[model samples]
Target: MMQRTISTTKHWIVIVLMSVLGCGLLIQGGYMQAKAHFAQFLIERAFEQTLVDNQPHKPWSWADTHPVAKMRVLQQQTDGFQPLGSDLYVLAGASGRNLAFGPGLMLGGAGLGEQGNTIIAGHRDSHFMRLQYVKLGDIIELYSTEGERVLYQITATEVVHETDMKVLAPTAEKHLTLITCYPFDQLSGNAEYRYIVEAKPIDAQPLYS
Candidate 1:
């Protein structure tokens, strides 16, 4: 009888432990989701302030990066280029942490809307997911903090190995190079290939209200 009672107690203990672990995981997931949503809100507000002041603004007080530009993808319509997605704030550094929040500008690249190649990188599954649907000749608009808007026409899209650095080399004319991991629908992480979207500056103008 004692042995049977001990076995029953052991089963109950295991069930209780598993229940605690499951709840802990649930709470952790909820916290992460909340943080992600809140972070985007802060980033958007900071980007707006940066545009107004023409200065860099951290999305959060402890953030190591700041908003440098805003980006929007557009599709050609009968009425002209229509927005395909909401504006995304491009962060200054292309670090893993910064990419988690939004696209990141590759350091040492051309300044936004300036000469040379302005490169930006983002996660394939997140901010740059729309790139997969972007066709050649689609429009990409980049807005600098100073309110200058540069329009780029998509020229090409290609897949390259992660080690292929030639796509990121400097260019003589103004260009935009967007990089994300390929293939877009992969179920696993740490993809070894990269998807490149190449664009050339076609127009520039001051953003108006």
Candidate 2:
């Protein structure tokens, strides 16, 4: 009888510990979701101001990154073209910290809507999640702070090792390369592979033209 009582007590203790752990996980998840939404709101406001003045605007006073461009994807619909999702504000500098808020323009890449390959990187589960559903021939539209809009058609999508730097190489012709970790459904962080989406301008003319 005593052994059974002791076992019962231990089981209750285990259950209580698990309950606490589950609640903690839920709280952390809620906090992260709230932060993500709030950050996007601030980023959107800063992007709008940048568009109005044609200057970079920091999403927050202490943020190290600023809005550089606004990007959105479009897919063909029965009626006409429709946005795949809401616009994502592209930040400057593809540092990991900067990418937490939105996609970041990688260094050594061409300027937005410029003649060389422009590279952007984002977290797979966050801002770039829509990329997984994108297919060849979809349209990627980028709006620069200078009031210029460029349309790029998705030409290729491939998965490559994370160490492969070829994707970041400058292209002779204008193109856009988007990078995100592969296997979006993975529960682990820091995947070894990367998913790349290559796009080219629909028109060869200068952006301002």
Candidate 3:
């Protein structure tokens, strides 16, 4: 009789342990869901601000004109973007609620329209949650302090290790490279691999009031 009672006690213990583990997992999943949702909201807000806050440029193309004409070229200068000076961009990746955390704007360069590549990074989990759905040839539009809009076309999307910042380096030609945590497999913290989206300037359209 005693042995049977002990067996029953052990069974109850196992059941309790299982229940605890299950509940822990449930709580963790909910936390992650909430975080991703918040990240999505942040990205949307940032994108909108970027569009509204870009600077304006006076349109004057000086080619093969005289030096006097160059001085005559006084175009209207528009407001430009104020750089965060950090590579921590709010991602707008996942189409749904995933933030798709990746990199934001970093140092050593100006905004989108100058020379070289302007690389941005965000988290695969939080900011870049939706990057998985991005296809080749998609458009990435950013506004600058000059009130000008910079256009980019996704030229390549790749997966690399965290050590591979080489692809994210500035190029001789203008481009925009987005870096984010890869796989999005982890429920929390940073990922091992990186997801990179490389884009180039395609076309531009003037924004008029």
CA-lDDT, candidates in order: 0.85, 0.86, 0.54
Name the candidate that leads on TM-score: 2
Give each model's clash number: 0, 0, 44
Regarding TM-score, does 1 or 3 come out ahead?
Answer: 1
lDDT of 1 by residue, 1-209 (tens): 99999999999999999999999977875675466557667888998998788777888889999888889998877766677777778889899888888889999899898889999998776678888999998888888888887899899999999999999899999999999999988835689999999998885432322
List candidate 2 segments past 4 Å from native. 1-19, 204-209
lDDT of model number 2: 0.86
Whole-structure CA lDDT of model 1:
0.85
Model 3 compared with the native: what TM-score?
0.58
Off by over 4 Å in 3: 1-103, 108-110, 145-147, 188-190, 204-209
Query: Candidate 3, after superposition: displacement of residue 45 in Å?
Result: 6.9
After TM-score superposition, the amount by which residue 130's alpha carbon in candidate 3 deviates from its true location, in angstroms, is: 0.9
Would you estimate the TM-scores of all the predictions? 0.80, 0.87, 0.58
The deviation in Å at residue 64 for candidate 2 is 1.6
Name the lDDT value of residue 54 in candidate 1: 75
